[model samples]
Target: MAPNKVDIRPGVSVLAVLRHLNYKPWFALAEFVDNAVQSYARHQEALRAHHGDEFKLVVNIDIDTAAPARISIRDNAAGIALEDFGRAFRPAAIPPDRSGLAEFGMGMKSAACWFAPQWSVRTSAFGEDVARTVRFEIENIVNDEIEELDIHEELEDVNHHYTEIILEDIFQVPVGRTVGKLKEHLTDIYRVFIREGTLELRFGGDALTPQEPPVLTAPYFREKDQPARLWRKDVSFDFGDGLSVHGFAALRETANTAKAGFSLFRRGRVIEGSGDEGYRPAAIFGSSNSFRYQRLFGELHLDGFEVSHTKDGFRWDENEQPFLELLREHLDSEELPLLKQAEGYRARPARAQLANTATQAVNNTARAMEDNLPSALPDIADAPPVDAPDEELPHAGTLARKEFNIRFRDKDWHISIELTEDPAESQWLVFSDVAASIERPRRLDIRVSMIHPFMVRFAQTDSEDVEALLRVAAALALAEVIARESGVRHAGTIRRNVNDIVRSALSEA
Candidate 1:
């Protein structure tokens, strides 16, 4: 028989496909954040945390609907060389000498195309006072069209030791409203850069600081002002049908009450944990991650896990399945149960400490009010015992911000409340801050960042109608009742101490 001939279809360009796909806004931001991270990592050889003493990333966002919207990200890192322009935007163009964060070259330009049709990058290298600029028009690239004149070139007139990316005519609207979130995302995603002191983030007048501090605290920290961590020896051994888990079951105490926890890592880089996602079941002390509760810090040396250079550094397999099932199973079967039991034991000390502190606080507050009250006011003895709710109280609001304190056993909890008027937004905020003398000895730090619409109403001035005062009073009273039931003292108690405060605050003349 004659040899059979086969025809093949051309594969789609990765850039072309990425350009059309609507990736999540954060994922797109991740690319720019990664660029900032890599730039600093490359320049700062010591692997210092980002946002340290001097180097930085600045993101400027302007949202004027009528005017053109623009999102610009600028970083103080090693800028691209003019000679490397051709290969910079090409796929899988990993520079031979590239290491640190920019191993894969597709990040810079591809990330822009995820949200905008046109974007521009401007850069300047060390010692060289001049900057170089490049413009990548995704619209042009998608159509497979190229023009000879529109190529990368050096801008000798420009001066700086920095790099910048400007995404013009944003195709994604969320980018405009999420500048705050973008700052947070970058702060967390590039925490290593920050701890190394090689990267900084500037928003408005404040240098963005992550809620969590540097991961390393010892030799590496003193050596290079870098955050270095001692690898954990904890591991899980799976044999036959069951799994055995071993790790530090105690929370490491830190003078800094800031949160820390076990973070997910891919290719030796962290993915999630802290306040973003995942849990550190061991870190019941001051951190937010549940995984850290078990101090489950160690290596999971699984081979052939697909870690793409352009990805957000999430763990994945070639088949696109999340590669954490086995890990999760191990944790659930072994680590979690033990962690829970350990937490119960740890809670005893926390509870006793809280009770002693709470009693003292109540006594102090009572003494302070002793001379300020009217004769008719009841004595501290007659005052109701600190009534705190055993269960968390739910709240919803908009346009108004409220806070209260609760007495829990031996602790004082500070609770903050905020409500939003938007109907489509989340409707409630509820969280607790334990008053631990060693950690949160002073005041409980509670926050409700998001507010619900149902609880939202327009702000009113003193001149409002009688009905308005009544409504406000009722709200305050309800809030007070909820606080009492929760054993939490309302931080805003003084403001709403008298009925007149509510009336005056809500009434509109």
Candidate 2:
């Protein structure tokens, strides 16, 4: 056959504008992969018959980063047939079948032009003896306002079926950290197909494999006495508007704020939450710092959802909130109650984890406080006397209390600290008796209310921050005891002054 011409005439303007499209590197690369996947899917029966049942579709994407950078995506699949040549090359020529991933024919042209100054496609259809090649010089075509692209042809084996897209002088190249991220996004997007063993997608000669997020398995937080159960729960909901979701909701085996939350899928490919940007809506995941937001995870396939042209997001059509509400209801229940379980469950840290946390906290708090303690003790010891009331301590809402000993000023000092969450507790800092006993060490126990207004406003929610604050409180409590021991009559005055500073100044924040 003579060299053929594919008239992309009407799309002259559209082709020039495509280069400016806001395409993330992964999504742009996905356009080519989508076409390859659709081709394999469409001709699966014929392809298997020709190449034997053991055959599986494999797509290799290679990036040449050395000077004069180039990108090539080669797929062993049912390549473009001679009859579909015009529709395949022409811009905006929608395929007769919109059910497949290649519904938008513009994906190839736009992605190719967006990637480089020049790109080419070479393919030989499964049952044909002729292989075709089409080179697109984007800069020359746009500058000259060319309407047609010449398709080159060559004789090939009748059974050969493959497509190779080579892009040269590429402007958009994945480099450094972006190369790793690109592989991750691509793996996540095609996870379903990869899991089914139908697709072998590779980048830089290495096959991309899906890494399944491990689900939590343990007794419910409130039902600690019960036998451990797998936390993964199957969820299915219908919106009654042709749209439906079917998937499994579960908590991660371990909390990972970066990897938590839902992955939304459409037609077996993830549209949202591919890679680290898992879909974390407040309606389902709660506040970002909530346990659910850090441990919860799932794969929800939206069967009838419409995706953006870029195939990056779903077009919910104002039903996103409603969709989220339905999703939340499914994930929450009196039986398992995924949301509640996720929020309430606290994994008992391993011995190493507990020790590591304690060690880190001690190192951080003591380092900073050691600098100020010497100067503070002198002032506390010289304080004037004020009558301090001795009131009965209330241990009603005590959540937890820990007792430890520290050697300070040649005396073994026993420290007892209590944490309380009760709203009724009026005292933000409750001081207990510091028994000066000849039988044992000088023991001073103090209580701190966590739900106090001052704590809620001034205190940070992190454990490290809370630990630092408590260390400061403990240091002050110890200082007052030492001042009283040193015969400072107004040692109680220091407590009153410190309370006023915390309440009047710090709480205002």
Candidate 3:
């Protein structure tokens, strides 16, 4: 048993692995930027000792789409040493410095191979007079014909301390449209780093700026003077082992478009969210499309948490469960009430819009009629006499007024409008339910015929204005019924004339 020695054989093809890397171009490019930033952070003391405190780290990325596409990323950080070249180019190598952003050493090699078939790196370590250069070709590695890494050493400027990666024969290049998207991705991922001025990243000739989270207002109770408002709360939670989360939650006054949810960030980079249902907690937001949850959004930073190899999401383990539970508790106890208050804030504008539209429609119709009318028409004072009032007028006791409850702006109101489902030959019918009334205060039954042509057409479209118009029409019908029951003279004639005018105006609109 002691004599048996088994040798391990590497059977994986480098090009085959590269083909299955599954990296978005933008995320792949971020690898190099991460490396550059980490390099600066790890060697900050050494860099300051060599140069002054004024020494700055700058990363520049240039992309060219002409002919065989090419991309180059250059950084003014402490460059790689001659001794570190072997580990630097090796795939799946663990980094020596793990405190910084670059933990796994696969970022550079994986990103380069994923971006292009041919890539090269040139670096001059700080205080070193010679620079080392290495070139990697996918075709050569795939064939397994290359045993030794070819590295060249050349004399460089005494003050030069930087690393530059150039990708040639690029399989695909980011162009006009994707360039902006790439910039946005990079900025969002490194917003904290950029905002703190720890790193300067330039894409093409433009410098990248941090994307600030939307400002959240504090939620306030709706009062007569200040009816609507938004509110924010600071949230912090600790899950032991130096792992903690801190951020702010905001309950907004209006519906959120895309900026609603907890944006989870780790190590100054956004891992998830700043979107709808980015982090789901049923107790806090209920479910997706819940009105209360839609108005809430925030950003939370995870101080110490394990991330996936791709760095796109967090590793949900036993330790993460407590953090999520704490977050849920905070939302339920503190944020839920603010969300309820925000409901009133959201409704005020919708109600105002409906009222304004109805008022404008009536005014427009009246103006059009006035402009078309002949100026020579006889006045109401000279009009023919009307018929005598009906002797058998309906009594007020014959009509019943029922109370209907409506919820608006987080408050309920009672009104005497009865709803019915019975089909009528006409579009709508408003009548007093005296026979059906047994209570002291009777309510008029305003029956809307769903089978009528007007109701059928409006129901199919489901427009907001259609609903508003229906409410207005029901109110007018109720007014007419009340006047008739009270025995108001000429009430029947007035109701007929108003109905005809409304019908004509609606046709014109």
Largest TM-score belongs to which candidate? Answer: 2
Query: Please, what is the whole-model Cα lDDT of each candidate in the order they appear?
Result: 0.44, 0.78, 0.61
lDDT tens readout by residue for model 2, 1-509: 23497777675777778889988888899999999999999999988887789889999999999879999999998999988888898888999998988877789988988988888999999889999999988778878988888888999999788999998988866799999999999998899999998899999999999888778888886677899978888989888768899999899987788889788998888889988889999988888777789889999999888888888888988989989888888888777789988876766434344334444544455544445545565443233332333644576755556666655455555656766666677656667545445788655577666555565543334457456666777676666666676677776677767666776676641
Q: RMSD, model 1, all Cα superposed?
A: 18.3
Per-residue alpha-carbon lDDT of candidate 1 for residues 1-509, written as tens digits (9 for 90 to 100): 11121111122145556666545455566677666666655666422233344535444333333436667777666666545555565555666765445666667656777767778877787556566666766556546644221434454533456777888887755535576666665556555555666455565446667653322223221133455333222444443222222332223322122333445444334454433433343223223323234223322422234445555544442322223343444433432332332222111113233234333433333333233322322232232334332324343323344445444334443434332233343212232433334554323222221212111122111112212332343344335444554556654454324423323442211
Model 2 lDDT at residue 308: 87
**Model 3 residue 103 distance off true place after TM-score fit, in angstroms:** 1.1
Provide the TM-score for each candidate, comma-separated: 0.47, 0.78, 0.64
Model 1's alpha-carbon lDDT is 0.44
State in Å the error of residue 394, model 3: 32
Worst 10 residues of 3 by lDDT: 1-10
Cα displacement (Å) at residue 248, model 2 = 1.0
